[model samples]
Target: MISKDEVKHIAALARIGLDEKEIEKFSTDLSSILDWIEQLKEADIENVEPISHITGMENITREDKAEDFENKDGIKKMFPEEKDGYDKVKSVL
Candidate 1:
């Protein structure tokens, strides 16, 4: 069972502000989660092998290629501001 003080301490460590009602609610929720964990502790896993992923994933293959667009000038003209053949922006600082 999780205590109210424990819930408050955890909330403080996480930089969360919780009222009394919220603290009580979280205490109840955390206690239920702890109970679920305790139940999982008794599961049988003698033949279970540890795996990084549950499903098999394969790396997708693609052609190592580069292509140029047909409308370079049209794309360049879309920029609102440009300087010296490059996009321009106002100084931030």
Candidate 2:
């Protein structure tokens, strides 16, 4: 069984604000997940081969290469705001 304090700690780490009811609910849910994992530990795997993925799909990613932008002026025209010949964006931080 998972404790309420353990649930609170996990919630804090995840930056989630869980009320008393939610905390209680997750305490039971997390305990069930741990119990299921415990059951998985009892499985017999004497000759099982370790595999990275179940799907036998190969990597289809293309090589990363910097391509020259052909539409340099198009971006400036599309941008709503500009400052001193440079693109002006709102402060992210």
Candidate 3:
């Protein structure tokens, strides 16, 4: 069983704030998840072959072709703000 302290430590590492109720709920949830994983570990799969993907689809790729940009000035003019040949947007941080 997962302890409340372990859940609190995990929340601290993830930098998320959880109340007392949430911490207790997550402790049970995480304990159940760990139990399920342990059951999966006990499964016998020695004869099973490892598969990368269930869908039998091969890698489909197109030939890389360079296309000339005919409307460079027109595209640049569409931007609301441009500075030093680059688009200037608001700072995210």
Candidate 4:
């Protein structure tokens, strides 16, 4: 079972501020979660096969193919400010 002090410690570590009510509630909730996990540990699944995904889906990605832009010069002309061959913007730092 999770104690109130343990819950408070967890809240502090996570940088979450919890009131008295919240601390009490979390203590019970955390204990219940641990109990549920313990119950699951007793289940037998020796014959079960591990699966990556429930829905079988294959990678449908297209091959990477580099192609030159048709209107490269035209697009460059649309930029507000251009220095050499690249766009010039305000300093960020």
**What is the Cα-based TM-score of model 3?**
0.46
Model 1's lDDT to the true fold? 0.89
TM-score of each: 0.46, 0.51, 0.46, 0.45
In angstroms, the error of model 4 at 18 is 0.3
Best-to-worst order by lDDT is 4, 3, 2, 1
Residue 27 Cα positional deviation in candidate 1, in Å, after optimal superposition: 0.8
Each model's lDDT? 0.89, 0.91, 0.93, 0.94
Instruction: List pairs with backbone clashes in candidate 2.
Output: none
Q: Which stretches of candidate 2 lie over 4 Å from their true place?
A: 46-49, 56-61, 66-93
- Cα lDDT tens digits for candidate 4, 3-84: 9999999999999999999999999999999998898777898998979997888796987999999999999998899999
Candidate 3 regions with alpha-carbon error over 4 angstroms: 44-93
- Pairs in clash, predicted candidate 4: none
- Over 1-93, each residue of candidate 2 has an lDDT whose tens digit, in order, gives 999999999999999999999999999999999988898778898999878987978887987999999988898887789887688999989
Error of 3 at 29 (Å): 0.9
Taking the candidates one at a time, how many backbone clashes does each contain? 0, 0, 0, 0
- Report the number of the highest-TM-score candidate: 2
